[model samples]
Every structure is written in structure tokens, then in C-alpha cells.
Target: MKITGYRCLTTQHDWGRPVGDVNGHVDSGITEVPILVLETDAGIEGVATGSTHDVDRLFPAIEGEDPRAVASLYDRMIARVFKSGHAGATFGGIGTIDAALWDIKAKLAGEPLWRLLGARDRYVDGYASGLDIALDDERLAALYGSMAERGYTSGKLKGGRDVADDVRRLRIVEEALHRNAEHPGLMLDANESWHRKQAVRHVSAIERELDLVWIEEPLRRWDAAGHAALSRAVRASVATGENLTGLEQYRPLMDAGAVDVVQIGAVWGVTHFLRVAVAAHARDLPVSLVGHTADAAVVHAAAAVPNTMPTEVQDLGSPIGVTIDQAFQDGGIVLGDEPGAGIRIDESEIAARMAGDGWRSAAGPHVRSHRTGLRLATERTA
Candidate 1:
């Protein structure tokens, strides 16, 4: 069936705890996440969220097109945006549509997205994130102490401003997890707040103390040499790729042996997300993905890849949690046998929330962190 139409939408919800960037540069947080819907002539529809910007312009390229020709359509869309300087960024929109197309494919096949993609594990190991460096010890304990009860075995925290403060925050997260924190899978993200030397210094001081899994965006996403340096200097591995738009950008980082773990998502789409999975697998490195406000789309993305576990989750208690049959258990997330991404898009609820003025106000078309600089760190590079 051909594509009929699409709509870009946003919904706002609270993090339940403080939301902040890595490095503590911006601790206060607000939410205005993006979503997109692609409808087809056959009454099948595909939905994707967690940042589908400029989805309106995508209709012209894919409207009246076959969703089954997802790869061809995706390539065409990429070529269409190549000269306009939006090809990479548009993939956020294109990736959503690509995911929707994959949903259509998997639905027609009567299998879940992970099965369609070739399942690695029905459920992947997950870690609790959404830990704000800005949170004081008491609030930190209250949040993560509860997270431990929710079945998370590992976690990452928003960190980076000061090395000493970063260590202090890490200690608190460890304590909150109690026994689970023993082999602490805690990771830190500087959100690109540190220069290379500063990242090395901070990680050096805290790596042994907390035994961090990785240091994310400690230097900068693009600084291959610097990342390699920091990775060499610290016992903890250096990781990035959360904000990269395509594989071309990832190669240099890999070439430099710049990262020990690769954290990716919203880079291109589930298609490229899988591509990143393949790339990481070829290199024999560990990979993880962004987990926030995602329902089934990301669940399938994680399950289809091996060696990628403990994805960063936004919350266990979210309004969107009810949209799917999958649930978090045993420190892992498992999906059920539902066609497509298995995401039951609660359209009415989405519509209600999209009515931003009523229950809550959406952030904006652009990504915004309470602190201005944090937004720049995560923007997709052309």
C-alpha cells in the first residue's frame, strides 16, 4: 500500500525526578519530546517518536509511495536531502518513517520487529539512567533507591561539571543501588562539557573509586584524537555516537580506538540503528542506545542486536508505559508477540498531550535543555 499522510507531534511529561545534562551544567529539566505518524492506503500505520523533527516536509517525498519499498524510499529521501544540508538531520524524520515502514513489513509478516530483524535476545539487559548530577544526596537516594527495587542492575548518571562533584554523585548512585552496585555498571556522561585534559583528570580520579563502565561525551563527539587520548589515559572506556548522524562519522572514532562502548540511537533510524549494531559487532565492541520516552520501537531495536545491553532508560514509570505489553523485569526489558514495533500507539492520549496547553506545555520544535549549552552538545552534525 502507498503512503497516504503523516503528522509531526509533540507531548510533554515530567521526568518524575530532576532531569539534567551530563556534567551538571544544566540540572533543571523540562520535556517536549517529538513523535511522528505515517499512514498508508491499506489502513496500516507506522509511528515513531523520541525526536522526529520536521516530519511535515517528509510527506512530499514519501506520500503516495509504497511503505514496503522502505529501503528504496529511504535512499531516495536521503538523496533528496543531500544538497539541502538536511540529509543527516532529516533521517530523524526519515528514520521514524523507516521504522514505520519496517513496522509495516514486520506486521505483514506477522512477527515482531525483533523477529523480523533476526532476534538476538527477546529481552536485552537495561540500566537506569535519568540520574541527574544536580540531584543532592537525599534526592539521589530517594530516586535510585526506588530504581533498585524496580529491577535495574546497572545505571548511568548525568555528570561532568566538576571532577570532585562527579565522584561524589557517583558514590551516591552506588550507595543507592545497595548490593547491586557492587560490580557497579555506573557510567558517566560529561555532555561534552570537559576538554580532553579535564575529562582525563576527572575520569582518572573517579574511575578507580567508582569503577565506571565508560565515560560518555567526556571530550567531544568529534574529537577522535582527544577521545583516543582520554580512553588511553583512563581505565574506564570512552564512549560516544549518541549524536552522530551516520556511520561515516563513527568510523573515525573507531579508527582512533576512541571509544570502548558505542551509545547510539536517533542517529538515522532503526534502520541505521541496526546498521550501527552491525558496525559495532564487526568491531567486537559493546553498544547501547538511548532509552527515554520510547515504547516498542526501541525495544525491538535493542533486542535485535547482540552485545548491546543495559540501554539508558528514561523512566520505568512513564505515561507511555501502558502502550505496550512489554515490561521491565529481572534487570531486563522483554517484548511480546505483537506485530510491527508492538507499540500500541495510544492516539487519544497522544492527542490529549499534544494539546500542550491543557495538562502540560511542550518544549519546542528544537531540542532544549534547561541549560542552553547542553542542547548544543547533542545536536546532530551535518
Candidate 2:
């Protein structure tokens, strides 16, 4: 089927999820953000959203291309654009297109995306992220407990502000998850909140006490050497690369022995993530998906890849207006036979949430006092 057109809809909200808190960096002030739908002359449609990829610039390149040839089309688009002037240009743009194209292709084939990707495993483990430092102890308990109730036995909390606070929250999370599993898988994200010495000292202190599944972005994303040093210093596995743009960008961290689990996410879509996933498989390392706003959604990429560890489902318990046709049970999320990512969103509810009272970024850790909201858009994902 030939591509016909596309649409972009976005709105702002008053909720935010941080990488870490109090000390961690990378604060974002986004909310609900935007969702894209690529329409085809054949009546197939694809949905996507993530990162600030220049989607506007991409439409012309793939306007008439075969959506079924997603990989080739993606590669062609990359070759056509010799250089990405901005940081997320390559990943944000390419990945979203790839996702939308995959949606169209999967619809044309009358199969779910996982079926095309391989369907080797029908389920991937999920973990609750976003125990933000900004939240009080009561909110923290509610969020984590809410997550566990949704059948998630594993969870990760934002750490790296204060040793005492981290320790205290870890216990709180442990209490929550233990309600289900005798031994729950726990993780942490410091979001480069600490200096090298501070990170080492902090992780070391936690290592002496807690059993963490992994520590995410423990240092600045660019700190390959520091990540390596911290990886060696900590007992927990290190997962990085969410901030890094592409495979070439991630290779250095892999080579430096900095990341135990390579994370591939929104910026690069399924095609790029598959490249990294295949490479990680060859290296015998685990690959994880970083969290995203649509309930930490892992759109069309999970089922067929190798060396994939438990992926993220950040807002599983939050009343985010987006959802998918999947079941969360047995500590894993199961995909439905729906074409594409199977995402369902309520634009009106999201607009209400965004227009409510405060303004906050959905992806990163930033909040502002903005009073106005984006003009709402009509819902379109089928």
C-alpha cells in the first residue's frame, strides 16, 4: 500500500516523571505530548509518538513509498538524509516513521506486529518505574503498591539524592512487591544524579544492603568511563543507552564495559532497536527497553528480539489516558492480535488531565507553573 498522509496531535498535562530526584539531572516539562498517525491510500493507518524527531521533514521522503517495505524504506530515508543537524533528528524521526510504517504493514498483512517480528515469546517481563523523589512517602507507597496490584512483581525507584532516603524508599518498595513474590526483582535509576565519587560511594552503600536488579543511568549518559568505573564498583547490573541516540552511539558504552544491559528506546524505533538487539545477542548481553509516556509502552519491538530482558511499563498504574489491547499478568505483558502497537488513547480525557491545574512533562523530570494547555485534538488510532 502506498502512503497517503499523516496527522500529528498533541496536548500538555500537569504530570511529570523524573529520571531521578532532588539531585539527578534531565528534567522535562512535557505532558501528554503528541501522537502521530500515518494514513495510507489503502485505508491502513499507523500510530506513533516519542521524542522530538522531525516528523514534518520525514513525510516528503516516504510519502509514496510501500509501507510494507518498512526496513528498506527506513534505510532509504536514512541514506537520503545524509546528516541529522539536531540530536534526536535521526532516531526521533526515523524511529517514529518506522513504527508508523510497521503499523501499516502489519495491518496490511492482517497480523499483529509481534507476529511479524517473530513471536518467539508472547510475553516480556514488565517493571514499574517512576518512584520520583518529588513524591511524598504516601504517594510513593500508593504508586508502587498500585503497580504491584496490577501483577507487576518487579519495580525500579528513582534514587541518588540521599543515601538515607534511598534506603528508606527501597524498604517501602520491597514491602510493596513482597506482597506478591517472595523475592521480587528490584531496580533503581539515579539519572546521573551523583558525581563519580558520590555515585560509587552511594551505590556501594546500597550494595552492602539491598539486592537491586539493575541501576539505570547511574551517571551522566555521556560518562562512558564513569559508567564503566561505576559498573565495576557495583554488584548490580548497569543499564544505559536510553539517552544515547543510535547503535553507533551505544557501541562505545558496550565496548567500555559500561553497560551490562544495553537500553534501546523511542529515539530509534524497531529497526534500529533490532540492530542493537541482534548485536547485543551476538555479544551475549541483555537488552532492555527504556520507559516511555504511553505507560512505558514497547510498541512493536518486543516479541521477536533476542537477549531482551524485562522491559519497562512506567505508567501502568497511573491514570494516563493512553492504553493498549494487552494483558498484564504473571509479571509480563501479553500482546493482542491487533495490528500495529495496539494502543488506545482518550484524547478528551488526556486533554482534561493536561488542562486540569498544573503543567508537567510526561517523559522526564520537570514541572512548571504554566496555566494554559494545548488546544485539544480529536482521537484517531484504530
Candidate 3:
């Protein structure tokens, strides 16, 4: 079957609280870059892309490609636009298409993406990603207490600004976990806010306090050497790569042996991220899907990867995940035997919420924002 058409949807929400991290806090409501729908000729359509900015520009390249030729289409799109610096958006745009194509292919073949990706297991373990930076130790303890009840034996805390304050927060979470007799594993994400010296020092101090599963993006994204050095200095594993664009950029970090865990995102779409996972597996490294605040797609991708370590379930923002038709059980997610990515979009709901807003360009064909969101649609579309 061949591609038919595509649409982009962007939605905005007023956040109830500030989503804080080392980068500062977002007090306003959050915006969602949800992927809409892609139509195909085989009488099958699916939502493979989740909340992205430029779903419109991705249509042309994929409008006529065969659904089964996902890898070829992916390579062509990457090679065609490789020199234009459109890697991020191109990857994002094509990712939706590739996912849809995979959905169609899998449906035709009567299999799930994971089975098609050759995984023997459908259930993968996950960790709760707590987002209660504004809460005091008592409240934070209560929050973590809830996580333990949910069956998550692992979790990650957002850190960066105040080292002492973060240390206290970690203590609270640890105490709560132990109080419940859960012995849940703990991890921290600095979001590239700390310097090498600060990260090394802070990680060392907290290492003995909490059994840190890993430390994510403790320093800037480009500091491969620093990360390598820091990895060598600390007992806790270093994890990164949520922001790195493509395989070329990822190669250096992997080659340097800088990170013990690689974080891939579905925002780059499912296909590209899978390729990265394969590369990581080749190096005998573990990977975790970065929490982009979207659900199912990344969770499914992580499940499909043979070397996946832990999937992330964020605590902040929307009630969408909790309201999904499927259930997240036993500290893991199972993509219940649905064809394609197995996510059904509530089109009427999405359109009404995103009414009066569609694809609009402030710059050139390769430069546009699908709506008010900051997602850069940088691909030249015919």
C-alpha cells in the first residue's frame, strides 16, 4: 500500500503548576505537539506520531512511498536532507510517517511492531519520573509513597539548582521507598545544568546515600569528554542522548564510552530511535526512552528494543496517560495486541481543542511553526 495524505495537530493547555528542572520552571500550562492522522491506500490509517510541530511538511516525501519500505524511505529522507541541517525536524517529520508505515506493514503482516522488530518479550519494566520540585520533603515523600504503591520499583528525580536541597529531596524519596519496604531503585536527571566538577562532586556524595541507577545529562550535551571523564570518576552510570539529533552525533558519545545508558525519544519518530537502539545494542549498552511527556509510542519502542533498561513514566502534566483506554500495569506497559502503534486518536476531541489553529509558517518552507508551539518545521514541502 502507498501513502495518501497527512495532517498536523497542535494543542495548548494551562499548566496547573510549574514544571521545574535545572533549566528553570514553566509556570504556564503546557502545550502538546500531538501527531494527528495519516491516510493510506490500503484502507488502514494510524496515529504513529505523537505531539510534533511539523506533521504537514512530512507528507510530500512519504505521500507515495510503499509502507513496507520503511527503512528505505527513512534512509532516503535522511540522505536527501542531510546537508541542509534539517536533521532534527526531518527526523521528527519522517518519524510519524515511518511509524504509520510500520503500522500498515504490521497490520498487513498480522503482527505487532514489537514482534516485527523481533522481540520475544512484550512487557518491559519502567520507572516513575517524579515532577514535584515545588513540594517540601514531607510532601515529596508522600508523592514517592504513591509511586511505590503503583508498583514502580525504580524512579528518577529531577535535580540541578540547589545541590543541598536536592540531596535532602533524595533522602526523602529514599526514606519513603524504604519505609514501604520497596527497595525501589533511584536515578537523577540534571538536564545538563551542572558542570563536570559539580556533577562529579554531587554524584559522589549522593552515590552512597541512594543506590543511583544512573545520572542523566548531568552536564551539557556536547561535553562528551567531560562525560567520559565523569563516568570514569563516578560509580553511578552516566546516561544521555535525548537531545542529540542523529546517528553521526551519537557515534562520538558511544565511541568515547561516555554513557552507560542511552536515552532515545519518539519525537525523532519511532524508526530513527529504533536505529539508535540497534546501534547501542551493538556496543552492548543499555537504553531508556526519554520522557517527552507523551505516552505509548515511546513505551512501545522501548519494549521492542532488546537492550532496553527502563521506560519513563512522568508525574507532571496532563491526565491523558491516566485516562488512556489501556491500563499501565505492574510497573510496566503492555501494548495490547493492537495493529500499528496501537494508539487511537480522538480526532474530534483533538480538533476541537486545537480549533482555529493549523500549519503556519513564519519563515520559509523549511522554517515554520505548526502553531503557537516552539516546534520548528524546517523541511521544504512541495
Identify the candidate with maximal lDDT. Answer: 1
lDDT of model 3 at position 157: 82
Residue 335, candidate 2: Cα error in Å is 1.0
Candidate 2 C-alpha lDDT tens digits along 167-232: 788878888888888988888887655657777777788878888888887777888898899888
Whole-model Cα lDDT of every candidate shown, in order: 0.70, 0.69, 0.66
Worst 10 residues of 2 by lDDT: 372-381
Model 3: runs farther than 4 Å from truth? 12-17, 54-56, 179-182, 315-325, 354-382
What is the per-residue lDDT of model 1 for residues 239-356, given as tens digits with 9 covering 90 to 100?
8988888777888998889988887864357777877778888999888887545645766877877777577766765443136557776666777788887766565676665322
Model 2 clash pairs?
13-354, 28-365, 29-361, 30-361, 30-362
Cα misplacement distance, residue 328 of candidate 3 (Å): 1.7
Residue 153, candidate 3: how far off, in angstroms? 0.8
- Candidate 2 backbone clash number: 5
Candidates 2 and 3 compared by TM-score, better number: 2
Kindly indicate the candidate among 2 and 3 with the higher lDDT: 2
lDDT comparing candidate 2 with the true structure: 0.69
Best-to-worst ranking by lDDT: 1, 2, 3
